[model samples]
Target chain A: MNQDILVKAIDVTKNYGHFRALDKVGLEVARGEVSCIIGPSGSGKSTLLRCINLLERMDGGAIWVNDELIGYRRDGNNLHEISDAEISRQRRRIGMVFQRFNLFPHKTALENIIEGPVQVLGEAVNEARERAMALLERVGLADKANHYPSELSGGQQQRVAIARAMGMRPDLILFDEPTSALDPELVSEVLDVMRNLAASGMTMIVVTHELGFARNVANTVTFMEAGKVVETGLASEVLSAPRSARTAEFIKAVHS
Target chain B: MTTASLTSSMSSTAETKYEIAHLRLVPKRHVGRMVAAAAVLVLLAALVRAFSVGQIEWSYVRDFLFAPAILDGLANTLLMTVAAMCLGIVLGVIVAIMRISGNPVLSSIAIGYVWIFRGAPALLQLMLWFNLALIFPTLGIPGLFEMRTVDVMTPFVAAVLGLGISQGAYTSEVVRSGLLSVDSGQYEAARTIGMTQMLMLRRIVLPQAMRVMVPPIGNEVIGMVKLTSLASVIQYSEILHNAQIIYFANTRVLELLLVASFWYLAVVSVLSIGQHYIERYFGRGSKSIRSSI
Candidate 1:
């Protein structure tokens, strides 16, 4: 484990019944790295993101954030599962954006952004509000501070979700297909926000089918096949001249 | 402010019209609705005539409808309804949460509670509560103050316990459904945001769930108002009980029953109107009231 590695998963295994979702997988993301995981459907790309956040627990192996083991504590050689309170405390350090853009429909855009900071971290209400406003402005939705999620378009909602994750000031943000649910025309706005965030040196792990965004914004690209990382390299080389037959086949299929 | 500008609203207009149209009517057959209305009116007119002009003694009913004793009974009935519903809703929320808490012990206890209270008849439960002394002669703790069970189990206390516990059983089901109505994504969002269970329920889950919970709960509240009449069976001195006592003495059973029925109808109508407004209030942020519980 390099000290510079912000997130590291060593031989992490997960199973749903007889199906192995993650078959002894390993991944490491350095601080300020924008790493993209690209794969076909059911290739465990989303499952990997979920495991990193402890939204779905891995049946075997362990995950670490910074220097701390996530969702568990090391006791001698045995690993003891931590309390939900502890898991949530760790989760506060990481932000996640869902495929469905899971904004709280009951609250306005500003309220949604401020909810995590004020409610979880106990930040001052006014402070959280001001920070939320700034993030909304950064996302180009400052004017929509009072708009409920139901009133927002899918692109606008995903942007707010991004701002909301940014409002946490998290060390890393995990995006699981954030633009999958948007209209083809609307995908550009969400991708633009991600590009800006990556350019500003935010650490991010994005699982996406959008090869263009992956190539344009991601520094590192990892190709996954059947719950295993098959290829890893710089985004340009991986997309243009991949070394694995599996990766080449997938890229050709996607391009065609 | 944020809109899905992927597609704009379309506008259209009719450019040409050739002919003005008139609605056609078939006059060969009588309208079913008209026939039904005529039948209903005649039946209602006959019933009203029978009640107003028959030997039920309308003057006795009119005199005692607003009498001091009858008014006192009405007051007692309203008090019982409010107090019992308050207890029921509070207990119901706890039980509903327990039922869904995922802890086997808590959920089993909640299930057993709903089963017993809902399974037994209300009248029987009331009687048991009133005579609770026979089963538990004294209510107390070791090294603490003690009192006779019968002394504590007054008719008023017994009535509230019986009606409220039963209502709580029904309300728990209604509340559980309401809680379930909220999307699971909301729960996950709260969890990912590092919200505790209590705060998640208070701020995120319940606010959304209330939109679905209000209408059925309003129905329960009105139902409780009528349910208080069962208190009279235990001599709780509510509206029906007062009427019963007066009729028992004066032998004006029909007149007394009519007054109670009128009051019941009046209270239910008022509660229904209140329910409509409350539903609208919680229904905000959504498109329409089409998804009401």
Candidate 2:
């Protein structure tokens, strides 16, 4: 409801057959703030994040990004709305990093980073390459720029994925368990990069099980259980000492 | 100190005993495998001898296989195989895109094409097109207000069309399976970066899918090489047809048939080898990593 919010979801619901993946979920993300969502496996955290990008369409309610209404295209009375192409174009402004570090396997890290800029933004190839090099350096993977995904370690690949997302110059970045698939020792490297991004004032929404990073980096931490947000507040308040029984139980489970 | 040394000696002996036991078991397993393999080899040799005993005519086979006309037919066979495969791959890519397109009508049209061609016997399809003159006297052109009849459906034209179209259907499904083999996440990744669907397909999805799809497609190419022999039925005068004409006139059925078979085998062997190298080239980077571990 805040005018300063970059993203607002009002009573958003997503249904699959008779099951409700997200039930009347409402949330808002303000400009230049990192919001971390923490939940159990089936708690619909991912569904909520995906709905923000219209990757998964919401069954009810409204979503606005930069005050532009999402999921509907007004026509002359008929309202022939929500084409895939339109959603894809909107998705450009909201970059998403998957749990699996979904870098294009066939392309080198440099090509992966430059692909979106050159192809979608119509930036010249050389310009895109230069920007991609800077991004790769920022992600601490300047040396590994020419390496393919298969040739890199999981941690390295995830960094390349971050660089790829950053290359698009999106308004917000969505991270779906970015470090969950990484090895224990490699987790810190990705978290360190994320911390740097956070410090630099990049708006990010991360769905992660790394409570340590979540506590250290996120401005707001939301706790959800079974398709509903149980508690959301300042990271230290929610993560260190949750209010609701469900949030407390989740914290206990994660910590233990 | 004496007691400690005695205990250590006992433990060392125990470890040696366990090692001996393991080593003794290994050779027994090895001997059993060797004996089983020997039996298989004996059985295979007996079967080969039985099948090949008096059927082969060494001299006639040697002479006919290397004949000038047969060699020419072999060249023609290879030419058609390469040309058809090149054309089929291009057509296959187009059809695969159509099949996966967002438009329902275009998708259905692609599905219908694959279904009709794949369901019908390829030989029958070839014959039908070759004999299409009987079914439709004229093919009407609407805008130009002209009609071109059965006279246009010459055997060569029909053969190429028939083979190419049928090959396209099978190749499309091959390509589609390849495309589908790529992770949907890759497409999403590319799109998020703002890559157009076409560019994404070209640079990301297709390259990866082609790696997965290559072996089956290579099989299709080899199969197409042999399938071109079907053109002989429509009097298209490919290798097999040319052989048939020579054999009928000379009345040397087995010898001439052998010549055709030899040529087919030779060309297919070369193509199969080429396919192996191609697959290896793509596989090398992945394979080295796997093998090193």
Candidate 3:
């Protein structure tokens, strides 16, 4: 119940028919803290991040952002599903950046950044455009604002995607493998931007394979395996000295 | 010589042995293509001679080109086409959305609508609408007002309803395919950005879907232009109907038919050009990448 906690998940469970994608997963992200969830592919790292934003509904338990339960409302003894409008209202403060850099292909970089502010929040066009331009500049893409997603390099597109997430003025941003789709050379550029964001005191939950980023930028690191968190501690403590054999093995494999 | 110089000299000798840059390049003759072209030209010339010498009177065709009745019919045809297409597109979007809805009842209703409308012949649908009075003698609010079905179901109404409803069925499939063509990631991105389902569809999904939809929708529009002539069966007074009436009186069937054909071709040609521009408009971001490939 700490007021500083931006995200709190308790016993979060998700299933894909017979296969449990996430099982009794619990995590906490304090305000202005970066938490990295690292695990092997299909180990529910991305699923945990998705469940936080209600992109994938949890089958059991709940998640809270900014002290308010997401996707549902408590009514006496029952938790009733909230209306889509209410869910959208709640989601307004929780931004998400995707691995594929799902920018509106029809829109330019500046337009993609301004879309949520202009359409969802109903901000003035000029105001939104001004802020969007600032975001473009912040991501080192000020000159590429007019370029479409196809016109951009993978690194540039991911930076624009990050700026798009920031443009909504989210209290927290969930990045679902944001750099997994990037080329090896492009990964560092996106990671650099994320590092700047972390330095700026933005709360973020990043599901990634980049242990180097986790070590440098993240305050807390959670190692997940088979839908369960294996270790959660300070980035240095967890990465340098993992308690779980699975975590160590996975880390060694990644390093190799 | 140093190793680099020795290697360069050896490579240059090897290159010169294979080099034939001074050879004259001769283009291959496409004998088959030339023969095909000559045959087509001869055929075209023969057809032109036959048309010129045929019993068709060019004077009547010229005189009737701008005739008031024909112009009125043209206007009516255009009006029907536009109105029916507007109705079709709106209904199609709704039906397509419903078809893909999670609710079983809505999906079933959409499936039934597509099945009934798309399966039946458009001609039969027009006849049924024209003669709807047989099934229901009156059509109006039950207690407030009453009007004869025959009066309400005029040729225009019947034709519009029949054509538009049938067009909607085909259009729904086109729209559904278009909607499906967009990546699932786009939907997730839109939702995360706090857009409502409708807003997401209107802005993110549909605009991207438009690139896939325009070509087929353009084909539908051109098809609709010609399909309006089918309404003539219900006395809708489209171009073909007016031409039929003239040919019936003057017995100048071929000339009048030719006039109608010319107009249809002209309208369709213009529409084709419009479709090209529209495709270009929707194909903004992806066009460059596609053309490069």
Which candidate number has the best lDDT? 3
The residue pairs in collision within model 3 are none
In the order shown, what is each candidate's alpha-carbon RMSD? Answer: 8.4, 5.0, 4.3
- Deviation from native of the Cα of residue A70 in model 3, angstroms: 1.1
Q: Could you tell me the lDDT of residue A2 within candidate 3?
A: 49
True contacts kept of each: 0.55, 0.53, 0.78
Off by over 4 Å in 1: A1-3, B1-30, B290-293
The digit string of per-residue lDDT tens for model 1 on B199-262 reads: 8999998888888889888988988899899998888999899999999999999999999988
Candidate 3 lDDT over B1-293, as tens digits, reads 99999999999999988888898999999999999999999999999999999998999999898888888888899999999999899999999999998989999999999999999998899999999999999988999999999999999999999999999999999999999999999999999999999999999999989888899999999999999999999999999999999999999999998888888889999999998888887887784635843
- Give DockQ per model, in order: 0.50, 0.37, 0.72
Which residue pairs clash within candidate 1? none
Candidate 1, residues A69-169, lDDT tens digits: the string is 98899999989999978888898999999888889877889999999999889999999999999999888999999998888899999999999899888
> Fnat of candidate 2, please?
0.53
The TM-scores, one per candidate, come to 0.92, 0.84, 0.95
> Which regions of candidate 3 are displaced past 4 Å?
A1-3, B1-27, B289-293
What local lDDT does model 1 show for residue B85? Answer: 94
Clashes of 1: 0
